[model samples]
Target: MSSTLQDLVNRAVFYSTEVQTHFGALIADAEWEVDFSSDPHLTFTPADGAVLRTRPHLLGSESDREKTWLWGWENVNDFPDAIVGLSHEVRKFGAAEEVSELTTPELSLDEELALRLTLAAKEATHKWAHYPAAAGAGTTVWLLVDAAEIALPAPQVKVSVRALMQGLTQTTVTDHRAAIESYVAKRGIPTAELPEGGLRMLFADGSADLSFDDQRRISNCDLNAPLEGEAAEQFAAAAESTGTPAEAATASRTSGSASAPAAEETAAPAVPTPSAPAPTPTDEPSRTEPQPVEEPAAEAIPVAEPKPDEPAAEAADASHEQKQPENEQPRADESVQPAEAATPAEEEPAEEAKPKKKGLFSKLFGR
Candidate 1:
């Protein structure tokens, strides 16, 4: 069967969600600034003085005013090959898989189109981390980022389920059941199919039982050990912030079809085929600092626009010279101070000292 964009997204979102959550926690207190010069880099500078940096590939841009998405390979702003290289891979994968959405240069936007495309790109490229940077003019440029600090450790049940719950609030999911199954398989988490049309996911610490409704929507989620502390609080907040899937579906219909094109595309740009770089030395050692509590928001970084007469050749040469090392760089987790650590002992609450419940999702959907 031909792979659809939705299929790719369903396969990728669950894993991507967990990775993004871990990434978000790492940069929570930092300010994001991007530089798209000869070499593109996204930097996160937190209050505690630890600065984290990563290489970014421009995936695409979404325009709120126009309600459209333009792929990075379109190179409307004339971004360099290094920045748009990965997007070419995504398009080629789309062409091979016959996923029209991936090959289409411009598409109508919806509440979930940008994220959905990013998820599909993640699946195709095997890149787990992404960022949506706020470009000027009501446009948001999505980027797939790479850095050592953002890599996830082995999957844990509580963290995975928490990520699923948190991810649901950010985008519309058509089939929760499918997404969960795909996630477990991709993450290599052990799971067993229940006779009653449920799934039990086993983790080192505990397991979670998921039940689907007649329509295959996640009707309820139960955990062997209740969630408590920060994880529980985060899940409760995400649940409170989002509406039911039924409500999201209704809103999506009223907004517009995510796949509909605003105009006919003449042709996709020829995919650029860059030769692979030779292997480089191991990345600089990782930092040993603690992470801060604030999340980074997508904000424009100040960059001087190239003069009209600037030569493209010179820019490409400069980019080649300035390419980042192949190995992972020192991540923010090594140097920054965590929020709890920064807090004074005298200010600690007595209630926080008491033992808390282990399970948090004892029927998340109010069965």
Candidate 2:
């Protein structure tokens, strides 16, 4: 059978969930601020006053009023290439894979579309961490982030399984067997197919036996060894906090495709399943407070009206011009200016503009 967007989503959700859980723990109790300027970055300040910085790629934005999603590559806000270059790579991957959702500039919003697209992006771009920033006026901007601090350690059986369970509650998954298979292959975990149609995954610490029903839905998940200490506690807590896969499926059916923040809001915090303990203050890099930047005035989400098509070479040239240098360092004193209203045709390059290097997605995905 030909692959659908849902199939891509199923293959990505498990690994995405595991990495997102690790990311949440790192930024727990932290305040975030984004600056889109010559040097774009997202700063996080925890209660302990340590500064954690990450380079953010604008994946897309969801508007509650418009009930639509706008891909970053659409350039609606006239954001710099530094902030949106990765999104272009996503579009290219989508075009190559024949996934229409990734290639489409605008889409009607659904309860889970933003999260699903983010998961698909994770699979394609191999950037495992993402953040849903509330960009005022009922819009949530979904960003895929990169930083050394958010990297995942070696995979653990308990942690992976907890993420799997948590992922089922967060979004709709049609094929649990495929989800598990994709996750294992992505993570490079050893596995074997059982004679009775079950699959056994071998982890360093233990093993898990997964059985699927005739519909390819997961029926039973049995771990060879019981979890201990905090792992067991986190697993139990996640189970109690979220509904079962059956319940999630029912909700997906009844909930119409209206823009809702519940999926974005609940996905990160739903499971208290932190993959690791919070970092100590001493371990963080010492840094000054991030300078305050002026917030842009609230406006209605930009509607994705049809546009005349440009020549393929012209479009490729425009994309090349927008690709920003990945190694440009942020200046501490720099303040974010509001995005200009001028069209891309009207904007001129600065004399001091840094030379472009490989796009972020190109480096990560090697495309």
Instruction: Give the best candidate by TM-score.
Output: 2
**Number of the predicted model whose lDDT against the real structure is largest:** 2
Against the reference, the lDDT scores of all candidates come to 0.53, 0.54
Which tens-of-lDDT digit does each residue in 252-354 have in candidate 1?
A: 2111122322111111111111111122233321111222212211121111222123111000000011111323211211221111111112334877674
> Deviation in angstroms for 7 in model 1?
1.4
Candidate 1 accuracy as lDDT: 0.53
The CA lDDT at 168 in model 2 is: 65
> Where in model 1 is the C-alpha error above 4 Å?
226-367
Model 2 compared with the native: what TM-score? 0.62
Q: Spell out the clash pairs found in candidate 2.
A: none
